[model samples]
Target: MPIKAQMEQLQRVTSLSVALEWVTGCPDLAGRDTVLKLIGEEVSTTIQGVIYSAESKGGGGAEMA
Candidate 1:
């Protein structure tokens, strides 16, 4: 599957294991690296609350936001 389509599938799934499975099942190492990079960027943005800034709760004693 194309990486974009694979990533869409990964987003629809709720489990990290399932996402990992998608990555591992990729036939091309370069494709896996690209997908992993995208995932990492998404994860980092989520962790920093940059993706959810509109709903940010003002840190609330947490490091996010």
Candidate 2:
């Protein structure tokens, strides 16, 4: 499947702990901090993308005063 399709599939999935476990099992990381940092960055980027898309489509809610 294409990356877009894979991402859409991921969006439909809700078991984050399972996903986190799979990601952390990758051999290339070789360290806890590296896995943690990469996960943190990816999560931050995903959240930012969601926020940006929502704002661009005028679906984002108003900020509190």
Candidate 3:
């Protein structure tokens, strides 16, 4: 599945193992951790994009304003 679709599906699942199963089709713990970490980094980057965009639009935090 596409990464975005996988992420959306994973977001709906409760258990990490279940999410990983959907991601990789196996119960590979180490690989799952790595994938999860990558997902986290991607999420962090996306959040940063939003924050930067907001700052550029003069909608950032109190300190910036």
1-65 per-residue lDDT for model 3 (tens digits): 34464455445443544555566764787886788887666666655655565566565544554
* Cα lDDT computed for each candidate against the true fold: 0.59, 0.58, 0.58
Ranking by TM-score: 3, 2, 1
- Residue 50 error, candidate 2, Å: 0.6
Candidate 1 structure quality by residue, lDDT tens digits, 18-60: 6777898899999999988877776665444432442353344
| Candidate 3: Cα lDDT at 65 | 45
Off by over 4 Å in 1: 1-17, 50-65
Backbone clashes in model 2: 0
As for model 2, its CA RMSD to the true structure in angstroms is: 6.7
Candidate 1 yields a Cα-based lDDT of: 0.59
For model 3, which pairs clash?
A: none
Task: Compose the digit string of candidate 2's lDDT tens values, residues 1-65.
Answer: 34474466457343443567777677776675676676667666665665565465564535412
**Superposed model 3: Cα runs more than 4 Å off:** 1-26, 59-65
Rank candidates by lDDT, best first.
1, 3, 2
